[model samples]
Target: MIVIDPASAVPPFEQLRRQLIDDVSTGTLAPGTRLPTVRRLAEDLGLAPGTVARAYRELESAGIIETRGRNGTFVAPQGDAALREAQRAAASFVDQVRTLRIDPEQALALVHAALRSAPTAP
Candidate 1:
């Protein structure tokens, strides 16, 4: 999920691109996760498809994400061991969610609840 601020001086494409990169770093968007199509995201954000496409293109060029023909874009894998483990866990969780046919919003809510209650390491 991304938000576009029309009032900001930063271009729409840059905003989209940067937010996605940040999401990847924060594990909000894990590697191998499929992204919404440019056209679909553009429609949702009220921006031109070109704007979204440009952002995707830039991300692809920077190795932050990749696009496969007719398959859609995905966050590219990272070199960090912790991130890889996180990606694996996320993929497993997603598979379990799909297998159980859980509502995505409900699943996300559960994850938020778990994160909130989880104890942090000292």
Candidate 2:
């Protein structure tokens, strides 16, 4: 399931994409889990079909999802190398915080605050 906010600074497609990525990374959505059809998901989320389609395309290109014609989209199996790459990409964000002169404690506190403020899973 996905939610969209018309008032969000981020675009609807990016929100959808990031949510899917988070789900996949956290294993809430396991590999090979089928995604709803674009139209259905778009309607459900009150977004344009094109928005969902664009998100799906980007996910597929990033090796996060795959489409099998009529079989629809499913989460891709993230191999060891892909997992390593994702981890490295995530680490770079921390490096950026360091470059900005943020202390480790402050950085960790910011992360904790964000985690605390995030919506709880259903």
Candidate 3:
């Protein structure tokens, strides 16, 4: 299940992407587990199908998930190292934000603003 924050600064796709990654890393979504179809997830999250598709595409690019034609998407095999590294980086960011006494909501807003200003990579 994914939550969409229309008021939050983060894009829906990024939110979905981050949550999926976090879930996989935390074992809330185990490896080899099948993921909901993009359309289904988008509908459930009240997001555009393209938004969910983009998140799925990025996750696949990160090697966190895989898709096999009609077989559907699944958590990739061999992503433990990648997931661990990502978790470490995320934890460090959280620690830094906490150390700076940044309000959680404000930090999330900043993330959304920064992401909006960031240039897209080729």
> Best lDDT goes to which candidate?
3
Q: Candidate 1 — what's its lDDT? A: 0.84
List candidate 1 stretches off by more than 4 Å. 80-122
| lDDT of every model, 2 decimals | 0.84, 0.83, 0.84
Summarize candidate 1's per-residue lDDT along 1-122 as a digit string, tens digits.
78888988788998898788778878899889899999999999999999999999988866778898899899888654234545767888999999999999999999999999986521
Could you tell me which 10 consecutive residues in candidate 2 have the lowest summed lDDT? 78-87
Considering only N, C-alpha and C atoms within 3 Å, which residue pairs clash in candidate 1?
A: none
In candidate 3, the residue pairs with backbone N, CA or C atoms under 3 Å apart (3 or more residues apart, or in different chains) clash, namely none
List clashing residue pairs in candidate 2: none
Error of 1 at 5 (Å): 0.6
List residue ranges in candidate 2 displaced over 4 A.
80-122
For model 2, the local distance difference test gives: 0.83
Weakest 10 consecutive residues of candidate 3 by summed lDDT:
81-90
**What digit string (tens of lDDT, one per residue) describes model 2 on residues 1-122?**
56777887788898898888878878888888999999999999989999999999988877888899998999988753246446676698789997899989898898789889997632
Best by TM-score: 3
Rank candidates by lDDT, best first.
3, 1, 2
Per-residue lDDT of candidate 3, residues 1-122 (tens digit): 67778887788898888888778878888989999999999889888999999999988877889999999999987767355656766788899999999999998898889889997621
